[model samples]
Target: MRLFIQLLGRFGVRLDGEEVPSIAWKRDRAAALIKLLAVSPQHRIHREQIMEAFWPDQDVELAGANLRKAIHFARRAMGTQDLITVTREIVAFADEVQLETDMERFEAAATQALRSGDPAECEAAADLYGGILLPDDRFLEWLDAPRERLQQLYAAVLRKGRLWRRLIALDPTDEEAQRALMQAALDAGNRGEAIRQFDQLRERLHAELGVGPSKASIELYERALALSGAEPASPAERIRASLAWALVHLQSGEFDKAAELARETRAQALGGGLAREVGEAGAVLGLTAHMQGRWPELFRSEFTEWVRSRDEFVPSVFDGHLCLAEFCLCDAKGHAAIARSAQELMCVAEDADSVAGRALAGLILGEIARCAGDLEEAETHLNEAERLHAGANALSGRVLVLERLAEIALARGQKWQASRLVQRALGDATQSWLSNHLLLRLQALAVRAATTPEKVEEAILTGDRLLTPGACQPCSMGLRIASAVALTQAGEMEQVDRRLNEAERIAGMWQGGPWAAALWEARGIQRQAQSNKVRALAAFAEAAARYEDLGRPLDQSRCLERMAAVMPAAGA
Candidate 1:
């Protein structure tokens, strides 16, 4: 049977242009299910996947039953059972049913337009755009990637020269068009026109974005200046160039180079009274030092102090990262301050509608709450963070939140839940960046240690893989502390001592900073396991002092409790 599906403007199913009545659909879920099937790449979906996506909170049998009922409703809506194909393992549109959607036509038009390189073709493609795949169903997660892909394709076609001119006419802040025009002008030996284009772009960005030109735009302008044999760049331009390099270094994990460049940029920004630049630079510096495991005191005493000293967060966009990094400097002693700071970041993120900011804030708040023994609050915060990240489709943030939640689960003696969470996290962590993935693997290893004794040896091998030569020092030390704890649990006294010593040596390279205390604490656990009460007492005492000095009362209290448990009954 011939079918025309209108998925662009408003969703509809029509048999040869005659619309299917809305009353035919028994429930909204039926209509939604039809739409889901229509948008699927192959017009087929796994039965289990549909159940999980649509009826996630239901049990397996209930969800499967719901799927069958939804499929029936969909068939009823279309007035033909033959229009849908069903099986025990899969659900799909009928292979024999001749069905066409506006989306397929739109995609075809877009591809043709890009291939033809004709402005008329681009315009035709743009005419097919109806804002979204399903405007009324914006809350649907499955539509997000498809909608975004279409939108990106739409924007990309506009990059054609003639189409670009039209784009600029529609929106002067179309930087892609501006860049293309500038480059085209340069190629045509119209250097003056290129410079003029850059000037217009700078002005438009300033007027609209409430910020300076991006590094790319600035570099373009500088290149034009150099081509014209003009005077050298201003000091500000040089600093911006350096800052751009610093960002590249940071992404590439060259912390030493990044830190050096960031420090220079920060100094320059401070002298120029560029508050936003200063904050960005400091954030980079803090991140660089964190990654390098160097100058830990400076992270707190210098960078963190400066950020707080400001009346308000200068570069509000950087507030989330800076605030979260500041959260790191707060040890157990600073619970109130940590909570207050996280709340501030969370509020800032909420105000900005920044998903990353909200995710980071929620993760930190949840961890702090967990340490403070507020399991309910911890779960709420962590789940919020997980939801936020999942909505944004950000893998790293979700993985981090999952790790925190798993830790909380372990703390509450929910080992089964923790094990499941860790398994999921490990999959994503292995796919993430190197440092994060390594640290995450260590966390997962710790979770592994909880369920069985033999897994401790597995944890040791995992640690070895992570700490093999040329490891990132700070991250390695963090993993070492964790691995030491695992060894202590396994009663591997000698291995624990060696690992603890390596942790100390590495921490010393970073000036025996705040994280060093954890090494000593792990050492105490090892001593206790070895039945060396006197040495264990000393190690615990030192760790407690270290935590107190670092303004972390929670860690201090933890050490004190361990000490209390190991102490003798003096009155006896």
Candidate 2:
């Protein structure tokens, strides 16, 4: 009898290679009891201890009965009493029951990798221990010991090497932890983070330890500075090092670098026959492509391929489902089909116990509804996504939800609400490239609410600052449209024409898509302002056609209305 427990995403217990779904869904006590036993070092646990641990508030006899029921349910779920045998002396997991626990596997793998001097393996192993142990079972005494151990171990690993930055991110004041991270940053040649960590540690040590950093820490800092003297060393030291680098780059608005690193990481993982690594790399690549306005490439390279691939690999199946939903949201080629695809993706994501995945799926569903002109459905899904993000403390997810809400408000002509929502989004954009890009688009919408030329000019300047030359085409097009619109409102007809022409030229060089439709719509406005009714009509028609093709019925209708108003006789 082999007992397998996976707490990677949500939680699950399996016996003999078969997952016990009912234990996960219907019996909380059984699930909790199994988790407690699996995490315990002593496979044998006393019945008194179980009763006291779980039901300290209740009568001893009642607690004992409840424990028995839970044990019975657990045995039923396991489908064999051979795995868990009970005696009056004590209850113990059978030795024949070889337990496979993620926590144990992760710790063993990380320790072995560190001992063997395999940084990539160590990093991968560390990533497996993403959250602290039994994060959801915090109140249970049985879970506390293992959770603390895992937390300390994770902190130690972070301090030793920056395999997982999120550990330090939770508690920056841990000096010993900071020291470990400093060493890791130095080892990886990330001069910026290394220096940053050194300074932080110096301050923390002075405040907490009443002394400078340790000799070993100072030596590492000095070495890092020396290495950074001529040129910054490679961003990362190992193959799996790219994950940390990708996060850094993603936060720094270096989408191209993030995409390139993700691609390299995927190729390396595929070469190494690491299916999970390949899937993670592919997901990162797909996300980078989507953020960089390369949705077509994302769908073709990752989303389509993963969905068609075999499900023997868990990571591939999970990533494939997530990518499918994201692709459905962005791909403009088939709205109905993509919407159905997103629904299916949601089911898979839920099955995987992926909170982030489900939140993202809901967001994509909202986007699909928004594109199809179903603002009510869009709002429902967006609200659900927002709720999930809040529950999970997912900053990126919240940003996405807010941006979509702002777009919906703008489409509905709720200018004041749109402006307020966009302002909130701007405040929350932080350092993420996607958030910043969304902020710029929201600012463009807010410009419509500007009552004065000065305010319009301010919005234009804000939009201009966001359209840095290497930024995503979608973001650039948004800024161009906003600038053109603001200039037109300010009675700067000549400047409007110039900006519109530039936007048109850029859009022409790019392939036709939803982004291009925005640029063309801006050009249509400029033509209408110039009294070139024929060209204005043509431009609006083209913009509408593109929007319709992208499944954005609301935008298409807006373009059609503009064209109809301009060419009343034509009645487009």
Candidate 3:
């Protein structure tokens, strides 16, 4: 009977026609032993050598017994008693055992195919080659060199086959068995498969490897789809198509239209009752609302509803947690509520191994600390967030963390460090409009540290850019107040009053928050600089009142100190 050994795909072994799935084979020890024999030009291995190769650590007696057991299993699996003829002295394949391994067939076929110039032959060689031999079984040191050589040969054969397929497919007379073979070649990576087949392959590949198809394969398949005039019906395509329309509206700053399309996609996902899809769509909608400054609509209701509906919605938790963090920081009544929400989010993130979740949790902790006037603790948490963001390749997360760090640095009088961090934050915040406000505020602080008049003017210009009509309210207020401060320093009294009035009006609309307190304090400082003692005192008192109302006791005390500096000691 004919006997053979071959590698299945890359990591499996087959003896004759039977497969040996387990590494601990009772048969000829699969290719590992055969490989030892094949490499020994003498076509025979001394019993001691075979024992030493496989069971180097075992005693001679036990090793010999294991080798004999392997030989017995191999012979039985091969169905040929004479396949591996072994004596008491040595082991070798019988003369009747004609080895027909795929590697040998593939190499021989590849040489002939290259000489014949036949596309079909080239494709046949490629089909036989499959992938590298025993790629994942690296514990076998003897297989590595030969495996690498076979891999190179296989890659060459595949390249030749790919070229032949394209050439033959372009020529009608040449496209016979060549076309079918070429299709199979392209189908190795499932590149030329129909959309349904491709999707199936994608799902299978992801299940097996924990990754999607290579980018090259996906691009090639997309081109093939265009050639065949068949639209891909994959879920990725559906998601991308809807996302593209939503982004188009988003880019045009049409929040309503963006929100509508995003909502429709989210509803569709929810209707399908797929938790992952619902979470993905809900995240997109929540992000859209954040950019549109419609936080209440997205977080308080829409996001909460989505979170309550989905059982395994991870992204929804992140979105809801972030929204609550922002709400707590912006709303005096929401601090404890936000902290509770953040704790819940951290639990979910730790459970899911989510890097983004951990980073956001750190940021939330920092916000809580900052709100409590624990600047040192706030900086520590923000630093932790930055470190996590850096390790996880989360650019936007890093940007937010850096922005918070800059704010703390400025508060601590580390102006130079704050300036550098603010610049980095601005560059990273390019994708998020909400961050632009922060960028503007940082630029103003940097300018305050600059000794040159040019720097002050540049800061004023930055403030003007941030004060555009559609700017986010908090960001615009920050810029307006900063502009007032910059104008006062430039000795432009008229422009300072104009900017201060605008800032006060914007603050009135903004009610109480960290931003409102800052603006009021900025106006008071400008009045003090202008020698308007009464106005300065009144402005400082108003700022102190606003800070006290926002639960910022430290800021309230600082405002009172500034007021005392400007006013006389009445009772004393």
Candidate 4:
């Protein structure tokens, strides 16, 4: 008899590829008994040992009776009593009966792969794992140790060079995978790529966990530096670390902390005569300002300082133009400048063979395409950006790309696709070790807006969780508006005013780039909810104007359509 068993993800048994029904195992321990026997090294167990393992609480007589029932069920489930022999106090699988199992196959494949030193075999092992062993039975005391042992072995196989990428894809925050990637780059004699890898790891660590890399990771990085013939971290290195951390704050959406750190780093770098560091710090500040929608603040931004002293910074055109790109991308009215600056960065990135620079440049172009409602172009640029990010194993860039793709899918009216993408982004964020409050809150707005009516309440609750202070004000405005829309739909009219009040207050008080346009749209939603046709039309019109001023044709088109909806239909 060819008996096959599956013990990963869930446990099941098959005979010649035919499934065994639950009726055979039914609410009982038959399947578990069969699984225990199948994976045992001996494929035979003492009857008393089995009873003690499964029913330590029962008296010996009762335990013996239960064991008898278990044996009967196992035989029926397997469709062959000849395979199991219970003689006196001993029970064992027949020596002649051959058993096949995914677990043993997975382990055997992994062992063979290791013995042969083959990447393909390692990948096959990874595929065989599917998930941790017997995930449904993970909580059982007997299963925990074995499951962990197998999981560790599976992870080890996946950590082999090139295969580390698969390990990271499985768990973005996996320190072992992160360390291996950096080591791989250094071993390849690509100092720059190695440094980029460290930067990526640090950013992900700080953003996701509100902490820095572990001591072991720092040690690994020091090794990379030594291998690349770089001197111990100089003053320039200090400034680089500072700027890198600032970016962690920025990309994770902690606008205030990021801005503060960037400003300090820029000043420190300038004082120390580290022009490269100064430019890096300035660029970090610019991206921060861009995300916060503080347009006037952006113009008076550190990029201006970098621009003025561009001559002092060697080959300043690339850094200078990149800084310019960051500034232009921050401003709602600087759409033309975003294009001009992004193009400049793209040229520099390509000329220099800088993966990060290329990814960022492509991201800028993708965002611009999104603003234009050219989903096709946006997809093209974003895909290119993702490729660059993947090549470097840059987790932060990849997550941002995924979120942008989700937004594009939302714009295309593919709700299911959009939701899945957003969920994927959220999943990546979690696994990336990100202190993800802001990203989660910001994404909650998109999810809230796109969710089904049945799920509206859950999304609103998610929005309410963001009511605490210190959220990125610009993004917060959108979250507030989305919550209000959900509340209005659910007929929670009293809470709508509070939500709208907060959104309107942010729009009036903060210079949050296109967040202001979003606020206008939210006002229209609020007025419509109040059943005030005239006011809603006016609000939509105002929103349309703001979007037009912001150079966002897509948003402008959406606002204009809303205005049209309320106008002719309701006493135009």
Candidate 5:
């Protein structure tokens, strides 16, 4: 007979290919006994050791009796009395019974991998280490040492494999691993990644230990800066590097970091009397503000600066235009503003021949056309954006373009095509690490596109995971609305109400935006589901008006249709 025990993550036992029932192991001591035996050297231990662990307080006679009972239960659970044997003071698995365990497998693989120094072998070992051994038994004293040992082995395997990201995930405070990763980034000429690594290490150390990075780390940081042509370089090079770092932080949603870098860069540029560098840093700060929803602040300063430099063909000028265009497209009574800003963005993008800039410009133009209910124009621009993003191998940009196209397809009742697009966007989003905003947007869309009960439930759960506290405000609001709609379709009225209520609470902070419109639309759906025709119609009408005010004709029309569906019968 062959006995296979799984001691990692969760505990389980299988005889051959069939799992033993949980009922068989219902006795806690029985399961614990098996765990102790499996982890022991050669699956054997002294009877006194087992009794001492299981019943340290009991007299020797009673403890031995309890151990016998536990042994009996464990053997019965394994479906063979021959597997476990007792001889005088020793307890062991029978010599004839072959026993295999996940712990042994992981250790064997890790040992061989470490000895050979093979990446593939290391990965295999890492995969075998499911999690800390017997996580459910975390409080058990006997498990602690083994758990720590296995965890250390896992970390060593990751480091030996040069899987720096995975190693960082394993222990963010591992300075040696972080330094290796930073050096690797520098070696690969990824100055932005090197800087990001250093910043993460420094911030983590500061937050957790009330200290900063070590001197070696500080020296490497200086090397990274020197390599990126920062301070002590030519003024122009220094300013450019600072702006580049700011943009990197912005792209990764590190707004505070981006702001700090941009402010420092702006001050240095001003000191050097560098107009272009100052504008570039200011544009980055403005864009960061826009991303964080500081709309009024962005418009007050960045707006004026963009207007003054609208004729420039610099990438930062195009970024300024893109930021303004996106805001205008989302705000009420800004159709003409959006058109103008998008036009300027496109002009700068074309002049500079920047594929990414053109892709972004095309995407915003597509969003504008889509909101205006011009499906044909929207599809044309979106298709161009998708092509550009694809040609440039820009995964995040392509995912955004696909999401817009999917929305258009869903509006046109092409559920199959829309589903396909959403799935593709989700798959690509997973591979794009710095696309949290994009991921949230795609998750919300998935919730909206779900039709069947299973799909709707999955979408709701995914939305819940994505909409954590301190998430991006606009995207999280959108996800809540989408989840509300999905819950409504699932006929989960209570959950739907909760989702809408939470959305309303979030929307309360912002006076006027697309979020307000979406909340009204969701409320209409909820009221319609509850068969409150008058309230539903009222809600949909308000939603339609809000959408129209925001220049979103397509959304307005959708709300109007809902209003019609809930309007009181003519005779009544």
Candidate 6:
């Protein structure tokens, strides 16, 4: 097309490779008329709407006269009456004009790039963004939506291309871009760059808005500092940093990487004779292993020794790590050995007066009690755990403790309280300074506590986030089961079956315990939803038996009640 209009950056018109000087138009409305047409769908707008946009306060007859004069000036300025099409009700560019606009070109490029999902195409499209549409027309109300839409599309292209620096260039105060750039820097081992990016963003945000960076941003900055070893430090400090990085990996569901890093850190700590580092590394490794359904081999010998001589260890060392592993261990199988170890860990925490250790120990004890159908004891232990965890600000521990407390509340038929507890835990889990594993687990708890349709739908949507590959296996399985139960309640039989199938697949790796019992219960719920009373009763019976064997009278009773509900009253 020989006729081209520029709406981005600067506004101008070019015909036959020659610029149309602004002096050609005696009236400014002539140019505005073309711009309005260019931005409208199919380059067309009704004459009445055009008049309202330009001269809203004028009478209809007067606006019509003004519109005709503007059209005359526009055709005169463009040096072609053929380019302006005026109908009885609509004004548009003529069919033979063969006109083009930067806005149209940009939309085409953006559409192609987004549809292709190719980074190179995205980068090309991002480059074409140039600037916002019609900068000179910044004050025009009609330009606002189009300008914002183009800017958003430009940002999306930059994001799809992973052009973080370019995105930051477009908007320096863009925290999302800043965060992305900072992460990219850290991933590339450019710690200084990462820190500098955060500092600049923080300074700019504070100076401009008189507010701090978001919680997510601040937490990420802290993590970068902790994991980057940004400051000169002793070997112990570096070891601690390594442990922090491992913890991040653990939280992100990279269990194998976390385990490997923890092992390396453990070796270093052992070489340096750093007992505290060694213990913490073991804790990291133990937690990763437990999440992955591995037997937590790191705790076998050293942990036993620590349990044997509580004074030989730092009480804080056992606070969340080892205690959490033992809690998970107890969950996997309520074995006497696991319970004894938890007890021993609790004793050590008490003797050392370690609040974190005590809190974690109480969490484990609470889980054991809850599993054994002792809701009263579980609530007492979990409440203590929650208080201590909150005081210490141990987020993961607090989440676990609150989850158990919620479960206990649910067992006692307090769905509202259970939901409140779950929501409280979810609120604190807003950051991933640790693995988002805890967050996924909390979402599953929400599904269980959901009583209303809206709540159930919201919980199910959040629960779907847990079905990702490489999620913590135990949490993933638990979420699927919980989701199945919720889906059954919602009368979504197809979704319930899909969830159950997925849970069954996950259970192939390791099954039994409350997970197995929960799976069976979920199946029972699904069968009952299908009105398959025989299958539902059988499934509930199996679940009740499993719960009975695990010493969970409450769960067994629930399952038994379900079985009774589904059982045939008499011969038909």
The candidate maximizing lDDT is: 5
Q: Is candidate 1 or candidate 3 better by TM-score?
A: 3
Off by more than 4 A, model 3: 1-263, 267-331, 431-438, 448-452, 569-572
Clashes of each: 6, 2, 3, 7, 0, 2
- The order by descending lDDT is 5, 6, 1, 4, 2, 3
Per-residue lDDT of model 2, residues 2-84, tens digit only: 77788643477777778787534466677767876777676677888777777665688888888989988877777776777
Candidate 4 vs candidate 6: the lDDT winner is: 6
lDDT of 6 by residue, 156-192 (tens): 8888888888887776678898998888888998876
**Predicted model with the maximum TM-score:** 6
Q: Model 5, 15-96: lDDT tens per residue?
A: 8778998889877788888899899888899999998777765689998898989999888887788888998788888888
Q: By summed lDDT, which 10 consecutive residues of candidate 3 come out lowest?
A: 168-177
Off by over 4 Å in 6: 1-121, 124-191, 194-280, 287-328, 465-470, 569-571
Give lDDT for model 3. Answer: 0.60
lDDT of 1 by residue, 359-439 (tens): 766877887776666778989999998987666555655776777787667666787887678677776556533323335
Task: List candidate 5 stretches off by more than 4 Å.
Answer: 1-198, 201-284, 287-332, 351-354, 431-433, 569-572
Q: Candidate 1: give the clashing pairs.
A: 331-552, 332-552, 332-553, 332-554, 333-552, 333-553
Winner of 1 and 6 under TM-score = 6
**Candidate ordering by TM-score (highest first):** 6, 5, 2, 3, 4, 1
Clashing pairs for model 2 are 159-180, 159-181
Per-model TM against the reference: 0.45, 0.49, 0.48, 0.47, 0.53, 0.56
- How big is the positional error of residue 98 in model 1, measured in Å on the Cα after superposition? 78
The 10-residue segment with the lowest total lDDT in model 2: 317-326
Residue 156, candidate 4: alpha-carbon lDDT: 76
Query: Local distance difference test, per candidate?
Result: 0.67, 0.65, 0.60, 0.67, 0.74, 0.73
Deviation from native of the Cα of residue 108 in model 4, angstroms: 66
